[model samples]
Target: MVKYGAFVLFYLSIVWIVSSCSSSTVEPDAARLGYTYFPLEEKSFAIYEVEETIYSLTSTPVTRNYQIKEVIAEQFRDLSNEEAFKVMRYSRQNTTADWELDSVWVAKRTANRAIRTENNRSFVKLIFPVEESQKWNGNVLNELGADEYEFSQVAKPFTIANQPYTSTATVMQVNDSSACNMKRVYEVYAQDIGLIYKEKILVDYRQTNNICEGLGDIQAGVQLYQKLLNYGKE
Candidate 1:
């Protein structure tokens, strides 16, 4: 009777352990959480103000500013057989001018990632569970030859164009090479609001083979940035 009781007790302990392990392994819904950072619902839209600057050794620096509006127009199946939202983008030289259709972009969200395609190049912009210091190749499938991007900030507060965001994520990409010069791009996103800010800068330097012998090397650079101004929902 004593041996039988001991065996029964061991069997009960094994069942308890298995049950606990199974419960612990269960994960929350990744798709639901990922969509909060990159919403792709039809008729959702955002507007931004863009600033561009160009620096060259041959002439003075040039600066231009504009505004862009992005709206989710429809849905379609992407090449990967996934449902993607088609976004229509419009731009204007200023707020006073009328918006002109600029381009169409595609965005899709999966259980683990959020992707956006522009100009025929697809990019993985966000990862699930939104953690800081998480790194992935934003241009992995695009063949853009860019470096791995990093989530430098998560759930941080940021403001753009006088509008404040309580929680935001910042993804940073820095690519420095002798052949292609140095470039850095920053993309900031707010929960349920999509991208709020974007900045890109590229710098290249080389010796000038001109008649001016004392001019030495020439430095040329370009910077482009966008800030969120307003948004609307359907």
Candidate 2:
């Protein structure tokens, strides 16, 4: 459970050469750019409530909820000698519990893109101009298979946790639904607040006679959801 849980929780980023291919693009306003959604300034931190659910074929499903804090600790040169930020993560059972150091990840935002390195996989999280219907390669830097990411709902106002965000965008990464299996992954970022929400769902249903008998019953899979609770810069 620990291995799969930790592996699924991390995020990924990419190479800078990927070209932007817009499909009926809706131009973003000049004031709300893509990089603002994921500010990488040192000492910036955000807290989130992470809920994870695991499903099994032989037993009932199990779920766990906890809180995590991610802080941009320091700036350093990555292997490629590019300027990057070191993000330290802490975990706790709840808000009242003390945070314990959990893991470390790297992130960098260039003039036109934002990149995150988690679990040794780098993926492009966002691209510049914040245009709706714009697509870019998410796995260009790593050996992982090609994955396309698109931006939608750009510079749109949203309300969460009783707080109103002036501008936000959605990164639609993957959406695959089948009779026996379903998988989806996406992340939302609010302008000036970084990642506001994320959800990843993967499920496998038991099939009989090569057909799904229990369409809604899970055989084995995982579901993870994260929502921002607070954010600040120190």
Candidate 3:
């Protein structure tokens, strides 16, 4: 009876260990899979912005021959709140640069809010983190008087860099110029497979004239499917 009891105890111990390992080994939630944050000193930043006006001169007839939607895609890397503020301040200051001036100079000041995964190689959430572009363009900057008004818009969701992300944005203001509020959400494990899995956008205005309309989320799920096939193969 003593030997039998000891054997049973050992069997139970083995089962317990296996159960513990299995539970521990299970993948974490998509939100936690590779969440990454940065301390003040560690955060770094890079800037990229696009303007539609430049394409106005394009012989390709931007709205017809080329994909004009991609132009609004702006990206920023890890940056401190202070750094991001400066970037925005400068962006507002150099609206001409962001619109028609050389991209090289304005690109240097590109900064926006973003959340990256722990690996740094992937992004979990990358958003502009601005409440309203109009407030900045109007009251703060005083670039325009009472005669000017503004609004913004947003996109739905999408993926990038082999991960899934959701984009939410909409028209923020419609003052001297038309603008939109945009954001991107990313996670290590997302439902779709694509570089640009999904997108949601709202363009309040195109330039100085017409309101932005008929703009849809550019789907790239198919391309991501193909890329995944070649991923890590080489």
Displacement of the residue 141 alpha carbon in candidate 2, Å: 1.1
Better of 1 and 3 by TM-score: 1
* Candidate 1 residue lDDT tens string, 52-143: 98889789879999999999988988888999999899999987899899999888988788888898889999878678898898888798
Which 10-residue span in candidate 2 carries the lowest summed lDDT? 11-20
Candidate 2 residue runs with Cα over 4 Å from true position: 1-32, 213-215
Best by TM-score: 2
Candidate 2: TM-score?
Answer: 0.82
Stretches of candidate 3 exceeding 4 Å from the true structure:
1-8, 11-27, 30-54, 58-234
Q: Write the per-residue lDDT of candidate 3 for residues 136-181, one digit (tens) a residue.
A: 3222222335322221332344334554345323322221222322
Off by over 4 Å in 1: 1-32, 175-182, 205-218
CA lDDT, candidate 1, residue 11: 99
- Reference-based TM-score of each model: 0.77, 0.82, 0.24
The candidate with the higher TM-score, 2 or 3, is 2
What's the CA RMSD for each of the models?
8.0, 16.7, 14.8
**lDDT of each model, Cα atoms only?**
0.82, 0.85, 0.28
Q: Hey, what RMSD does candidate 3 come out at?
A: 14.8
